[model samples]
Target: MMGLENGITDIPYEVHSSEDLGRYLIAARDLMPGDLVLTERPLVFAPKALPDPEACMPCVGCYKPVLTDVGERCAKCGWPVCSGNCPGLRDVRHHAAECEVLSLRPDCVLDNMAEYYRHDALLSLRCLLLQKTDPENWKKLLEMQSHMECRTPGTESYDEADEFVVQYLMNNFINKFDGKLKKDVPESSKAILHRICGIVDTNALEIRLQQGTELLGLYSNTCVMEHSCIPNTKHSFVHSPKDKNDVFKITVKIVVPVVKGSHITTMYSHALWGTQARRQHLKDSKYFACKCQRCSDPTELGTYLSAMKCLGDGNNPCDGIHFPEDPLDDESDWACNKCKVKVSSSQVNMLISQMGEQVDNVQMMGGSVPTLENLLCRLSTFLHPNHYHIYSIKHSLVQLYGRQPNYMSQEYLDKKIKMCNDLINITKTLDPGNARLSLYRSVLQHELHSALVLTSKKANSDGSFKSDEDVKALLVEAKTAIEDALNCLKDDMEETAGKKLYAVIEKTKKEFEKYCKEKQLNI
Candidate 1:
């Protein structure tokens, strides 16, 4: 096959299309891990249509949070803006046009404004504005698959969103812009509006803004990449500095090496989700059944992420794992790997549902280690050690151990260390290079370092040199692990959690070096 290149020469991937998969991206040349495969600027991005009330409110123009409710509102439109001097508000193509329309609407006047009018139409309206202001970008957006036929008019997803677009947006805003403009408002056809909404729903990526508020971004190029449960490339959104224009850029990097001609993929579903859950999400949201390698494998690449415990005997539980006989079939039987005991898929589903409810209840109680521990013990009766549900409880414990009151005892710390290590191993096999794995690895290293320091202090108080060599060796190990975590997190420091963790790890490194010097050990 011949390679086709876009205007950007540095991008290693090119878009390709087929009847079955539609448009997908393929690597034009060999790409190593951490190599930049593509960089994309969003054609039209906006805050989520209906964000949680508790979420920070973002500026209408730039999508950055105003930090306080009292921040500046546009003089003409009365919508949130960072400041009167905000550059985004001055852009003729975007905010200036939006302000002009809102200024003409008497219902949008500050005192007469309704709550529904403020939010329900912003995203779709922004998209409409893009069509008028940037025709080239609108053309690019129209090339994307909207899957409009699948989004039938009566469907729940289509009904509410379509009503909001037609009633609140087109009627209240676009059609009403009649006599107020020097130029007449562009006619937005219902068919075109429906197609735009479908495109946004199908391909928009969830991105975090500068103040950590989430927004939906529609990238012209990156939207064409296919979804995979085991994706080779990872993508992150970087916000432009305040000095620069408020443009957001997505950087796609290969997490695993890709040979020339291999298709570059990105994940749409959560990495930690099981095959069944991932497939269901893809089917519902993207309108396709994913037959990815990870989804087809019963053992989930040997991590047994969806395994259940075998019920062999009342006295001694079977050490076997239970998995779906045919993972692709929702009604497939679940069979034990060792005992060959088969159970109907319905029975297995019911058990999992009950367990999930119980887990949700425990999570709602929040930070109760004893409650979580008791629940984990009870769940062990029916769930295999490597099951996703069991891993969820263990994952909670890792966060609770040292932070909770009275849970920092040496015994608990040791248990925490072991659980963190186990989770790290599971993640390495199933979700390696994931941001969560880097976090767990960092937590484990920190806990180990703390434990070693305490042990060395106790031993020194008792005048013992036996543990000196052991402590030194452990300190080196902890130091090395933190270094690995630092490397993993170097590119992610823009996030709040990453920033705090980066500071903590940097301080810990200095402390480790100081301790080594005091002990006269060359580590």
Candidate 2:
């Protein structure tokens, strides 16, 4: 293999294909954790279109927010933009060709905002423009999987894309001007638009700007990794300061050591979602039923994220947990581990649905420690201790116990510490390298440190400490936890919650050190 690597020496991964797993990335050689697998600029990027059209209003030119009702219109295209001097307005790689195409329409500029702007069609237009502006990238885009057969005419995805994107671009931009383009408009066709929409839906990754504006970005090499419930690769965004054309670049790194010929993986669904939820989301969005190791296990690697408590009949009040007999088979019956009582999938679904609505309502009410605690206590009756729904409520309570007022009792502190430890352990087992659970782990560490500190302070106030050595030990552990939290959040960007918590933890560490020094307790 070493002798065969004659031409490509720098690349760390190679693309491989099979009948079951389409095109996917595989390790080119033995790679260690944190090894840079790939770094690639986006093929194309545009502001994300939301369900609510007014949710995000970024300028098509510079990708900056257009603050006013009627933003500064482009002289050529009559579209909302940040300013006349925005660099992206005239760049051939971005908005220039789209501007030329939009300039051809008779009703290019309209008085009504909704009539004037179609946010959903913006990205499709940008992708279509690539055919003419950047032919090399256009070929690369075509090579990506679109799953157009699965997204046929009558499908919800197909109809939505056709109505919102394809027809909008056609009726407004191309066909509105005598069904002819003046040599500059990128080649547009219904089939091509359908493919582009499918490609964007399947491959685009969400990128958030420093100003909190979210955009969708499609990358060439980064999208090749296959999906897994437990992924071995993690990717982060790097803001490119030197290159203005590519505002954001993504860097993919291995979270665990990989042997040569092994598949490089990334999680496509939320890490906290249970097996059923994760599989369903993957099937609906990416068009696949994932049978990964984590998905196939009924125990979910011992997290029991999908387990429920059995409510046995009055004749035998049994204390047993119910888990799916076959996690891969959605219709399979769930059986109790101890009592051997069986329940149908529909019964479990109905229970989960009812619990889900309650959970949603409580979360929306927002974090009052007492309220969340009460909710968690009630959920414990039906859910396993490590159920995903209970984990959700406990996550809120963990942060709230120490941060909120009137909840600093010794009991609350102990509860906070226990929840932090449990969640950290579960996440560690599920995501060994903290790749997917970095933010959660960071917060858990910070909360654990806070609880330990408060506990020590309470002990001192009550004169219950054995000696200053005990206080010193607690402070030392607290310092170590805060440092670990900081390490977990080191790669977070400036505007993120992790960075903000990083700053808070930094101050807390300094204060702890200072207090220890003043008390003549060296740490």
Worst 10 residues of 2 by lDDT: 1-10
lDDT by residue (272-303, candidate 1, tens digit) is 77788888888878988888888899988888
TM-score of 2: 0.92
lDDT (C-alpha) at residue 197 in model 2 = 97
Off by over 4 Å in 2: 1-8, 50-52, 68-70, 105-116, 177-186, 460-463
lDDT per model vs. reference: 0.72, 0.80
**Runs with alpha carbons beyond 4 Å of true place in candidate 1:** 1-7, 49-51, 54-56, 64-72, 81-85, 92-94, 108-120, 179-187, 241-246, 313-317, 403-405, 435-466
Candidate 1 accuracy as TM-score: 0.88
The best candidate by TM-score is 2
